[model samples]
Target: MSISADSIKAFYKDGFIMIEMNKGVEIRFPVSQNRRLAVGTPEQLNNIEISPFGLHWPELDEDLSFKGLAAGDFGQHSGCPTRNRRPRAVAGR
Candidate 1:
């Protein structure tokens, strides 16, 4: 299923992005979690486009799905080692 955002804002000072969903739920994630977003200036980060399927940062060339955000999946560089890293094989006993 696809989820869409009602509005979005970049709180640069707070170091996170906030999305207000149509269901009155708010989803937030730190900018540091995203590689492109972490490097964006306040102006660039604040410039957001909320589409039916997701959020877009044209200046940063980044797009994140609303469904994914709600699920705590903050793009490829989310700093969650388990999410981004490949599983290592265990040595034979």
Candidate 2:
């Protein structure tokens, strides 16, 4: 798939970041779901730069890719539960 982001917006109040794709597709996720971003202040979250490949927060040292976000991935290898992992049901009571 072609990876291109037209624009990116961060909502501090809502605690989510939104990425608008070139094809008019928008992807968003909670800031709390990311390792580096979860603890970032509004000021830190606000200091962001958007690239064709991903979103970058220099102050917070955070980066998120359009493809990753679109695929329901916030981050990995950070000890946080991935969005794609489903909880297993208990077999017996």
Candidate 3:
């Protein structure tokens, strides 16, 4: 329910606050205005590149930037980075 000096220091440094509130962490990785890499305390937080403002899911093998996530531009689509809007399919192709 509370945070300490040491942990707070780590928070600004890593941008991800590891809080023991229930079965998860209050991680706000990616210090962007709107981009927040929310993940579980133990599992979801890891497995990705630990950045102060971003994360890389090794299992998913994907990376996400703050701006990208904010604008919803990039992310895992069919296990790959795809456009946010669907491409128009040809008619009667």
TM-scores for the candidates: 0.72, 0.67, 0.32
lDDT of 2 by residue, 28-71 (tens): 77887788888888888878787777778899887777678777
Q: For model 2, how many clashes?
A: 0
What ranking of all candidate models by lDDT puts the best one first? 1, 2, 3
The superposed Cα distance between candidate 2 and the true structure at residue 45, in angstroms, equals 0.6
C-alpha lDDT of all candidate models, in order: 0.76, 0.70, 0.41
* Residue-wise C-alpha lDDT for candidate 1, range 1-93, written one tens digit per residue: 644444444334478887765556777888899988989998998888877788889999999887788788888674555675677899994
Candidates 1 and 2: which is better by lDDT? 1
| Backbone clashes (count) for model 3 | 3
State how far residue 48 of model 1 sits from its true place (Å): 0.5
TM-score of 1: 0.72
Give the range of the ten consecutive residues with the poorest summed lDDT in model 1: 2-11
lDDT of 1 at 26: 74
lDDT of the structure predicted as candidate 1: 0.76
